[model samples]
Target: MSLLDSWTRDLHEAEDGTIRPTYRKGTGPGVIVIHELPGLTPAVIDFADEVVEAGFTVVLPHFFGHPEARSNPGTLTGALVQVCTSSEFTKLATGVTAPLADWLRSLARTLHAELGGPGVGALGMCFTGGFALATMVDESVAAAVVAQPSVPFAIGKKRAADLNLSPADTDAVVARAAAGCQVLGLRYRKDRATGTRFDTLRELLGDNFVGVEFEGKGHATLTEHRQQEAVDRVLEFFEEKLKG
Candidate 1:
């Protein structure tokens, strides 16, 4: 059987009546794991499995692509184009939060209610990386991780600096950070795709933003060019923030 077949899948309905399929497993405080640009590939599933094994119920929303699909040039290009043209994502805009984040927040709320914990954890990678930060505006989100956030396509200086969040959302996140909710960030120092977003996060969240910067040009911190140190840091952050 395929690995995807082993996970439980359910359709989640948002407040707007839109429904999306979510793959979930494990037990404990909820953790919503958002996939990167090329969809929920095998690497993503493996990472989610790690989160599940760490003693938390994990929900992976299928925003795009086939589950368990292998990452390749063709699949990557197709997924990129789909997201770049979709209205749910702000592919080339700065200072604007994507509309899909609301749906994700709704999902988080539902999961948190079901799991009945202090709060929920969220990890967003690559194209969907900043989505985790945007979702943190909700009080239900306790642990938020942004890995290689490359939204707005990192087109220029402004795009690189933008947090992909609106002024109100940004203020809420900033206030939450000030209120003792720490945000975790992971990225490679030489990855141009990440741009200056990490720097902006540091400035916005100050010491509340714990950033783990790896050396060289690695973009996929949790998968692909997997980093053991980053994996350990992520699990530790979730445990400290969610399992406490």
Candidate 2:
């Protein structure tokens, strides 16, 4: 059976006319769960299921790759190629928001308008991690979680520290943070894939940035390299920010 059989699948269209498949389930406040490098693997679905059980509506948008495919080197490579070649993504540029973020922000606004809450929660992992932070620039996203945000490819010092946000978008995120919207970040201290962006987040968001760094080496905190403690912190953050 397909892992997403239980999810209500629909194609969501952004204001810019960008349409993508989205799978939604559960109830209560809404949360947008953007997949990682490969796609919506079973592990990613499992995490979303836990969020559903925790009493909140969750939406998984199919940005790229085959849904429910297991994460493997081949899958990762294929997705990377697709993302890199696509204009929607900013693979190696610094201080620029991926064009994909506009669609994501539109999705957040739609979900928030439908749910009728103060805002919606957004969790982006790995390749899409910083997307949650970008989406938070809008008032619709109240709780933003970025787990191992590896964007701009982390190829060099500049890209490593890049937040993958344009100057205007960065200012908007900073303003939102100052308005009391807290962003949660998770990653391993030694995970070079994430680069030094966490430090940049600290400098930019100040006290509004709540960082959860695990010791040792690992990546994909909420999916591939799942950590119970980190998962718990994410749930608690969602509860406090989205449901409180």
Candidate 3:
């Protein structure tokens, strides 16, 4: 396996008939780190390890691609094709929530209940980024980070502006925002793939949405193009929200 860490691996079954392999490590409060579409590459695993090292139990669910696949253009393209063909994802649809988010929220609740903390932390990158927002409706997610959330692929203006959330989910998230549940978002200012979803987040959550925009074109805020500031902010966010 490309991931050479002491992680416990098991299968998780969702109520919606979805079963996925889960890799877990570390201890303390629970943090769910949902990987990008190219599958859980070494960089993704490394990011999860950082979260683990920051004094939190990290759960990484293999929602797509080979868990240990090496990152390359071909592998990334293959994973992209898989994501585009999957019915569970809303690859080209605007204003539609991906069906897999429900399963993720359920997983978060399970982890939080098991670990016993103020709540759980969720960090989603790439295609799964906005899933963190959807997970917030459950109230068990105390810290949510949306890093370079590129969904519906940002193929058009509307998709660019879409939050990949259903109307009900949007309302729930907005309510949480109003209730003081802060959502952290990070993306490059010129990353077209992210579109204007950050703008949408700003509009929806107002000041509750913390948008961290870096200059130039960059994605994978917590991974490949790792930003130390972003990493520190995420750890601080988890500490502030989940460690109490």
lDDT per residue (tens digit) for residues 1-244 in model 3: 3474589998888788788889999999999999996889889988889888989999998877887777789888999888888898888787778888888888988898898877899888988998999888888898899999998788879988998898989999999889978999999899989999998999988899999998979887888888889899899999999886
Sorted on lDDT, best first, the list reads: 2, 1, 3
Which residue window of length 10 is worst by lDDT in model 2? Answer: 216-225
| Tens digit of per-residue lDDT, candidate 2, span 52-124 | 9999999999978898889999998899888988999888889899988989999999999999788999999
Clashing pairs in 2: none
Clashes of 3: 0
Of the candidates shown, which would achieve the greatest lDDT relative to the real structure?
A: 2
Residue-wise C-alpha lDDT for candidate 1, range 1-244, written one tens digit per residue: 7887768999999999989999989988899999996899999999999999999899999998777788899889999888877899988888899999899999989888887777899899999999999999998899999999999778889998888999999999999999978999999999999999999999989999999999999899999979999999999999999988
Taking all chains together, the TM-score of candidate 1 against the true structure is 0.98
State every prediction's TM-score relative to the real structure.
0.98, 0.98, 0.96
